[model samples]
Target: MALTSARGWQFRQPSVLPGFGLALGVTLLWLTLIVLIPLSGLAWRSSALGWQTFWSLATDPRTLHALWISFGCAFLAALVNVVFGVMLAWVLVRYRFPGRRVIDAMVDLPFALPTAVAGIALTTLYAPNGWIGAVLAPLGIKIAFTPAGIVVALIFVGLPFVVRTVQPIMEEIDREVEEAAATLGANRFQTVSRILLPDLLPAVLTGFALALARGVGEYGSVIFIAGNLPYVSEIAPLLIVIRLEEFNYPAATAIAALMLMVSFAMLLVINLIQAWSRRRYGYGA
Candidate 1:
């Protein structure tokens, strides 16, 4: 009787909300309206540039430099965020102390603060004559108006994404797992690398991807601190704005399309890595 009942069972259980077809239709419609349509329109505009024009615009030295700065600084910032963000998440999850809640709340400040406001504040703190920069100036270390400044701004905006992404997953891990590893003669390093890391790898990759995406598209905060120097600190988004301001729509569209393609490719790679990590580590299993 059990075997017969099992064989008769449906693949999908009924839902209170709606059927699968209705849910999927709504999902696709929303995606089309919100995502697909805009992207398609951008591609259409870019296509009007002609392949040769598009390729030339994309390979222009100034455009290449801007794109390089944007992606490079973003990658560096995301890498920094992954290291510090993971450590911060671990601290928040594993320890308790005075001002713990306050510190935790501060992590979300970037999300709450307006981008322009954050830029102004960061500029105030890191400009040549500013408090932090003034101290570093004597030692000949410049933070503001440079690629390094862009990196700092990106890190500021992207850190929350990493911390928030990893925190919940860390919370879900049981303390007993670590204890068990220690009981089996595992040191702290071994427990973390062999036991905790495997489970955490997928989540870490997700956070890294989020941070990277945020960094790549960032504009306002970076602009205030980056000095907008051509071929030095000018970012792709800023370059697009420059093109638009100059009424060069074709050039603007070309840069935008290039950014979209590159961002999509990077995110796709990260997602593939996430999937592989899940399979290799049996994370969900």
Candidate 2:
């Protein structure tokens, strides 16, 4: 009887082994096919060159300049997005007014617009003889075909990341908390600073990191406005393309691998912060 009862109890328990195994197999297969294969090819191609040759190519002055410019512009663009995106998200969530729906829809335009089209539009708007550019040119603020232009293109493309990431979090924030702070005689500024900012910090950082990553990898929009001047306005992605055009496959792959490593490290740090924030917040309370 004891043996029969034990068997019955075991049979009543749910069996996840088959389903878990199937899911894991499918995920691994997909990652191997879509991600691992291409990355492996890049690494293999890079390794074809001797290690010294690879190191020389990656550390060349021009290559280093391009990398520096790419990261600097991406950092600045992401910073700009963090400030304005938070304000935009706050307005969209906390206020109700005419044309609010239209404004909300427009915030997503960057996401849907073709990157090339966005680049072209920005170039046209900022070009010397263009309508907006014509006015600014008189003031000595040149934008098109400059490094500033590259930062502008990146900012245009990355804005949606910060806005979208923060918007939902702002919407879900409890109004009661703010009201409680207010009832305790906290002013609007104090209430927002003390009650709202802490809760929103994680989402803000996540958005900033995402925008930074996108800006770092951005090519289509930046290429049009950057002028592609080597060691000047050229970005790392464009440099990679130029290397490929020159048939320097090993050099291109080496640069790509380096960028991938740096980006991965940054993403890992951002994810750790996000996890820690979530734990502090106690399951999005």
Candidate 3:
């Protein structure tokens, strides 16, 4: 009788295993088609260049200069976003000023605005005779068609990532903990420094990492503003494009592969830091 009861119970249980397996299979197949396959192809094409050729292409002086410029501009942009994005997130979450909702919506304008359009708009606004550029020309601050313009374009593209990532975390932060810190004789600055910041650090780092990653791969907005002058304002992506246009497929793939590896390594380190922060704060898995 016990055996029969067990059999009946087993029969009544829902068989979701097949459905779950089907979904997992579909997801893997989709990812392979969209991402993995193309990346694998790039690696394969680059491998045809042989080690010596690959090394020479990647280590070329012009290539090195472009890499340096790309990394430098992206780093500066991400750093700026880290500061302003956090402040914007804090304001949106903690305040209820007039036009707050409108301002919050504007934070995502970069995401909705086409990259080319944004690039053109920014270029026009910062051109020598343009409104903002007219004021700065007297001070000798050239923006459009310069390295500074690259940083500006990157900042424009990356700002939304930091703001969006930190905003939700800030909104979910417990107000009671802040109140408790205040009640314990901690001043406003002390309360924020000791209580709020610690909790926000993980989210802030995640946002920074995301912004940095986006800035590193940025192309559309940057090309228009960068002037594409080799060893000067040219970026890695533009170099890759130049190589392709010159029919140097192997060199292009090699440079792209190098960029991929470096970006992956940097992102891995950032993710590790984020994971450690989350574990320390008991916030993420």
Minimal lDDT window, size 10, model 2: 9-18
Could you give candidate 3's per-residue lDDT for residues 14-55 as a string of tens digits? 675657666778999999999999999988888988999999
Q: In model 1, which residue pairs have backbone atoms overlapping below 3 Å?
A: none
Model 3 worst lDDT window (10 residues): 9-18
Steric overlap count per candidate: 0, 0, 0
Instruction: Give residue 140's error in model 2 in angstroms.
Output: 2.0
Which regions of candidate 2 are displaced past 4 Å? 1-18
| Candidate with better lDDT, 1 vs 2 | 1
Better of 1 and 3 by lDDT: 1
TM-score of each: 0.92, 0.90, 0.91
What lDDT score belongs to each candidate, Candidate 1 first? 0.93, 0.90, 0.90
- Candidate 3 matches the true fold with a TM-score of 0.91
Model 2 steric clash pairs: none
lDDT per residue for candidate 2 within 1-285, as digits (tens), equals 988986674423467555766677899999999999998988787788779998998899988888988989999999999999999999999999999999999988988899999999999999998877899999999898889999999889899899999999999998899889989999999988888987899999999998999999999999988888888898999899999999988878888988888888989998999899899988646
Write the residue-wise lDDT of candidate 1 on 105-211 in tens digits: 99999988988888888889999899999999999999999999999999999999999999999999989999999999999999988998778888989999999
- As a whole number from 0 to 100, the lDDT of residue 35 in candidate 1 is 100
Best of the two (2, 3) by TM-score: 3
